[model samples]
Target chain A: MADLLTPENLVNALSLGALYALIAVGYTMVYGIIKLINFAHGEIYMLGAFWALLVVGMEQATGINLFVAIVPAMLLCAAVGMTVDWSAYLSLRRRLPLADGLSIGGLTLLGVGAIFYKLTGDTTHAWYSEAAHGVFGWSIVALVPVVMLALSIGEKGGMLGRSLGRVSSDRLSALITAIGMSLILQTLAQLVWGADYRAFPQESIPAWMNEPSFHLGDAPVLGKELTMWVVALAMMAGLHLLVSRTKIGTAMRACSMDQETAALMGISVDRVIAFTFLIGSGMAAVAGVLYSVKVGGNISFRMGYYPGLLAFAAAVLGGIGNIRGAMLGGVLIGFLQGFTGGTFTIPFLVMILVLLVLPRGILGEPQATRA
Target chain B: MLELKNVHVHYGKIHALKGVSLEVREGEIVTIIGANGAGKSTTLKTISGLLRPTEGEIRYEGGPIHLVQPSDIVARGLCHTPEGRRIFPELTVHENLDMGAYLRKDKSGIEKDREHVYEMFPILAERREQHGGTLSGGEQQMLAIARSIMSKPRLLMLDEPSLGLAPIIVQQIFEVIARLNREEGLTILLVEQNASLALKTAHRGYVFETGTVLMSDEASSLAANEQVRAAYLGSD
Candidate 1:
């Protein structure tokens, strides 16, 4: 008990809590807007970690510092997050017909092929390669648009029209898509950067990050932990201000309240959703870096799964859509995990117990209307 | 200021609006009085770009608006106060009003409009810090109208503003609408089930039944029409 009460344990708990809070905000905000649990968000966290590692590796070959790597990693992860929305979620939200989606997807693939054929310019010239590159590319450009145009023209044909009108009603499909996206991201990461854990190059990390910045009782507090706390707190403060004090933030809040009504108010619901993903993913990037640093630079394709699950648990524990709730939930879960043990059993049990008591989590507002 | 020509809307196989054509000139309060499921709300929604018409055109201020997004429609100064007082429940009254001016860039203009809204609805002013959900139904309706007015709209489309309110509150709301039309010269297209109150308040009226217009005339003529009275006004 005395050992648990030590300052060192307290600092560790706070650090862990801060990390969870940072990642949990993404889940909460996304859920707030679309009512979809973005299962792929954990993969975004993983990608951010890998991006940081990749950047750091480049820096070692070229002498760039760790701080400089943060922005690029964040930007790359943000792009991936937005792309996931555009490819998987947006069409479903718009209720575009599957046929339209297929045709559009085909057009997009054709465009990509055309671009590839143009860029590569048939240098190899083997019959299979030429057919694969040239014939397929040139044919798709003409064929796809004609097919799509015909579909558009024949839209009034009852059978085709009815077949094309299948639309998603709820968030279930999006949730499934998010899970599939997570798997795809994980597989791609494994293919690109082997399945084994890669240690973060400590030599490439700045001295300030690796060295002890101060002491808490008998234990020394690492610079990395201090950075995580400061950065996370700062980001939280900034996010709070943005959500409360800005026009975009107000629009976001309005959207979470009622999407159709928000759109009627001239708030671009789509833009706001994308912006939420960007901020959430960017924060996830920051958390990823701090987490990788704290874990002695070890990064694996599967590193994000447990932490991501814990953060999601944190989001639910706080109140899924409530920002402040996520912060509080993160702190509680971190403290529980850190003080009790690294194992997830206690935290998971706490989540279940808390949920059983407060059905909406700690701060989730009870929905007034069923719709 | 707004016109819909041969507009048709479909909800899957259910044709909600069939060749529904209407016009609202600038500074006029035009009302569409209809029974439940008569597509009055659908007409307003299509004009506001919440739902697209399967066929036809919507023109606002001589420009085609059918292809525009809802936000862009609002940005162009056409605001819709939807059927429900869908106020941001968790947001304070002031924040709700702020959201109304989401597309506006002029700080002074937005503030001025906000003040104007408060002046119009003194109850809202008194409860500026209160969460919208905490307000009474009448107060919520007032907030909804006040929120729409915060956009400084050239045309305001209101869908059933008197819904689920007491008689006295309904009178107060109509008076506010009259005052806005009289004083500000605001253009309004109101959809209502209360034919009596709507006809009294509007300059012109359209009577709807089963997704088609049954009659269109000056408000007084519609009020006096025997068919309208028998079906809608509950009069002999």
Candidate 2:
């Protein structure tokens, strides 16, 4: 603990925390408004990094390349985020009667999963002999019918329908859809980019950017790290202002509280929700690019998976729907990595602790808590 | 002016509002009074474009508002302050008021109306920075109405403004309703459970029962009718 108290470690912790906060805020903001966990947010993060890598001159990033990388990355991610929201969640939500749509959606996904499993059997592991390699694909194919059957019985107005209709169709279905969205994004990434562990081209970084320019009380701070920290902090501050001061931001807060009420206020709930996703996804994009640079310039399809999970933990720790809570949670989670000397256990431990002890979260309120 | 003709609304399998017809002229306080399940609130919600009527026509300013989106309806000079004090719980009072004028692009107008609302509810001015949820129930209800007022509506639909409030607060709310109608020339469609209070405050009243209107007349006549008095106003 004493050795870890160094300025270098503290700087690392802060940078890591900034990344997690960027991702966590997406989860919390989505949850705050529509109460969807938006499990696909991790993939958004990954896509941001991937998109940045694809931007013009990123591979040979010299002077201004790195600075300009985030723009395209964020724009692409925001577009995808909004598109996914409209196509996946909105279509289901907009249907006249939710039950029919949910059943059809649930069934269609399962059928598609079946077709994918039947055809490729997960080509990533085609060379391997283990039949379980395609288990994730097979499981979705297998589970949908059972879930559908159980839910359909509720359509006949049984106790389950009366009690669990909102829970199952709205909350549970959205959650499952989110998980499916995450998997779909990963699969799509694999299909397009392949399952290779793609690396951020190290040549993109100017040598001076990686080398320490100044000392933070004897701890040398690299230019890239300084750049990332500043960008992340600025984004956080920008988010706070946007949510607090901007007209759209006020609409977002209103919708988060009560969509019906917001609608009466002449605030388009659909537009506000789309805006929330755009902002959150944009932040994830910035985080993705920054983290890629920080982690030895290596990028992968699965990079966001663990970090996304940790950011979620950070969100819950601070309070699910509270913005400031998410920021605090991210910093705390970053400190956990440093304090534990880097381990997988600390995050889960913190999450489990938060769930058990602080159910509403540190700053979360009873209902519609957004700031 | 607003008119609903043969409006049919359903909540899933249950028909919540059945062939409900109502109207409010350009400058009047129209109240619909009923028991909890009478679909009075549903009527206002349907008119606000929050709930779509399965069948029928809703015309605002002689235009079909039923086909319009809720925000569009509000933008076209209609607003609904829903049942319950529905405020952005985490947002400050000022923010809540700001959201009320969300569709308005005129900055100076918004500022002017905001000051007007603060004048109407002085307590809200003092609690401007406090979160909406932290306010007392009466205060929240006032904020809800004040927030709705910020929209500058030609026709405002208030659903049960007196619900769960003390008599004095209810009186205060009703006085504001009367003042808005008298001074601002604003038309109001009010849904209320307090039949006596609503009848006294409104220019006209409709009695609702089981998803349909049982009676419609001038407020004093409804108050005087033996059956209406027995059913809603009580023996006193």
Top candidate on DockQ is: 1
lDDT of 2 by residue, B1-236 (tens): 79999999998799999899988998889999988899998998888888999999999898998989998998998999988878788789999998888888899999999889899889999999999988888999999999988889998899988878899999898898899989999898889989998999888999999999999999999999999988887788
Predict model 2's lDDT versus the native.
0.82
Error of 2 at B95 (Å): 1.7
lDDT of 1 at B162: 94
* Colliding pairs, model 1: A200-A297
Model 1: per-residue Cα lDDT over A1-371, one tens digit each: 56676677778888889989999999999999998888888888888888888887822534556677788889989988887777667865786776665455444444533453455343343334334433443443345344443443345454543455423223444555566566656654554455567756766578887678998887788888899999999999999999999888888888998999999999999999999999999999988877888876468768889888999999999999999999999998999988875669999999999999998999887885611
For model 1, residues B167-199, the per-residue Cα lDDT tens digits are: 999999999999899999889999998889999
Report chain B TM per candidate.
Answer: 0.98, 0.98
In Å, residue A324's CA in model 1 sits off its true spot by 0.9
Expressed as tens digits, the lDDT of each residue in A60-167 for candidate 2 is 644446557789899999998997687567754664344655555555544544564566444545323333523564466346444544554554576666678755
Which residue runs of candidate 2 sit more than 4 Å off their true CA positions? A6-8, A56-64, A95-166, A216-219, A365-371
Interface RMSD of each: 2.2, 3.2
